[model samples]
Target chain A: MTINKELMKGSTVILILTLLDRKPMYGYEMSKEMEKSSSGVLTLKEGTLYPILHTLESDGMVESYWSSGEGERKRKYYQITKKGQGLLKEKQREWISFRTAVDQVLGGGPA
Target chain B: MTINKELMKGSTVILILTLLDRKPMYGYEMSKEMEKSSSGVLTLKEGTLYPILHTLESDGMVESYWSSGEGERKRKYYQITKKGQGLLKEKQREWISFRTAVDQVLGGGPA
Candidate 1:
């Protein structure tokens, strides 16, 4: 399904953090995993993913390190920090609450 | 619960459209109804509400008319257009799909 960009704006951060919480992943790997996990419903474009990763790193929500991969190619991998885990919990709660609020207004889900 | 403003951004339009879909309403009435329907979770602040209503009016999704209420006060009431109804259906579908996608990534809810 074609998702609205506006709707995807705030969600991108949550998706990235959820993936990182599972395991440390390089940028490309995270994007691929997100696509796979969502069954291709959510694809983090290279243009969008890098900036979010950079911001998350700067905010101390995640930390990154350079590591050599299968081809001896250095890749930057991001791991969720303690702070990121805390924030992720909060965002997840907020997501559920927000979804409930929207569903209430739309009148189509559990009340 | 305090929602992230970023998450609220894309949803405000949908909420407004949903309310207007039910019936014509002045700005204040719509805000109040939204708060009530969402069980006080979604409050549309005056600062944020008017601009959206005005934009929706200009976009032809909704049309506005001045109506005199009690105490001889004139309020600008908005009613959804045919085009607006069409958009509302599309947005509602998108919302459900987007929520499902988020749920899938979060590892919660029905698949």
Candidate 2:
């Protein structure tokens, strides 16, 4: 599925954090896993995911290290930082609350 | 609560459509109603809402008309066009599916 761009915007951090919290993975691997695990719901383009990964690293929400290997084998692997984990929890809670709020409105506001 | 910025970005269209679908509303009214209905989960600044509203109008998903009155009383009210209603249904479905997909990943993939 082509993820809605707008929803994808806000969900970037949580999704990254959620995936990284499982295990460290390189960008290409992360991209593939996002699609596979999500049952093809999220397909991350390199252009979009790279910048987000860089920003997350700079923000200290994630950290990356070059794998020790020859040039052809080397790749940057990202792991969620402690801060990222905390934010992930918060974002998850916020997501649930946000969804409920929208439902209330769609259901015609407060009962 | 201050919404997670990214979630707000993706949710912009649906929120606007859902509210305007109920009845015609001016920008200010829509902004206020967004906060009220979402329990303050989403707060749209005029800068942000204006651009999206304009985009929706340009896309023919919605239409706006000025109230026939004095300058102070005149305000442009937006209503979701038929195309918007169809889009709304599609977006709502995408949102639910997206949420479930994320949950599947967060739960550590297939059981």
Candidate 3:
């Protein structure tokens, strides 16, 4: 299916926040994790995910540090802050409520 | 609970696109719809929602037209385009996959 730019642009932020909530990870690791976790169903491109990472970092919701691994390549790892956790709760609440509303409408109630 | 800015910023786009999928709505109407649909759980502020609406309109995912309603209010109504529909489908798929992954992790299968 064709992905629309508008939808992709809007949801990128929440997706990143949600993923980062799991643990601290670098950009490449984050992208790989999303792919592996989604079983390749939701592959996040570097082009799309990096900008969001930068944006979130700038917003201070996520903090980063450099660390080297097996390959000896230094990579920046990201961890969600206290503020990020709070935001995740809010997003979860909102998503549940939003889905419920859609279900109500789709369930054949008065539109 | 205090909502974090990062999470809000990230999910705002998907929220707007999903709401618009229900039917054609204007900015004020969209904000009101989110509030009403979420049972006041998710309120969309004009400050945040309008810019998104503008961005979506510009991106061609949504189209707008002016209509005068009661009290001589010339409100611009927005409707999702075919491209937007494609986007909604992609988002739905991605969201489902993303949530499933989170569930697996939270379920303690492997962490």
Candidates 1 onward: DockQ, in order: 0.47, 0.51, 0.15
Best by lDDT: 1
Candidate 3 global lDDT: 0.67
Candidate 3: misplaced stretches above 4 Å? A1-110, B1-3, B69-71, B109-111
Model 1 stretches astray by more than 4 angstroms: A108-111, B108-111
CAPRI-style grade of the A/B interface in model 2: medium
Over the stretch B1-111, how does candidate 2's per-residue lDDT look in tens digits?
A: 776676777777888899988899999998999888878877888999999999999999999999997667889999999999999999889878877887777778322
- Per-residue lDDT over B1-111 for candidate 1, one digit per residue giving the tens place of the 0 to 100 score: 767878887888889988888888899888788888888887898899999989988999999999976787888889999999898998998898889989999983222
Clashes of each: 0, 4, 1
Residue A64 of model 2 has an lDDT of: 95
Give the TM-score, chain B only, in order for the candidates: 0.90, 0.89, 0.83
State how far residue A106 of model 1 sits from its true place (Å). Answer: 0.5
Candidate closest to the true structure, highest TM-score: 1
Off by over 4 Å in 2: A66-72, A109-111, B68-72, B109-111
Query: Which is superior by lDDT, 2 or 3?
Result: 2
Which pairs clash in the backbone of model 2? Answer: A6-B10, A7-B10, A10-B6, A10-B7
In model 2 chain A, the worst 10-residue window by lDDT is: A102-111
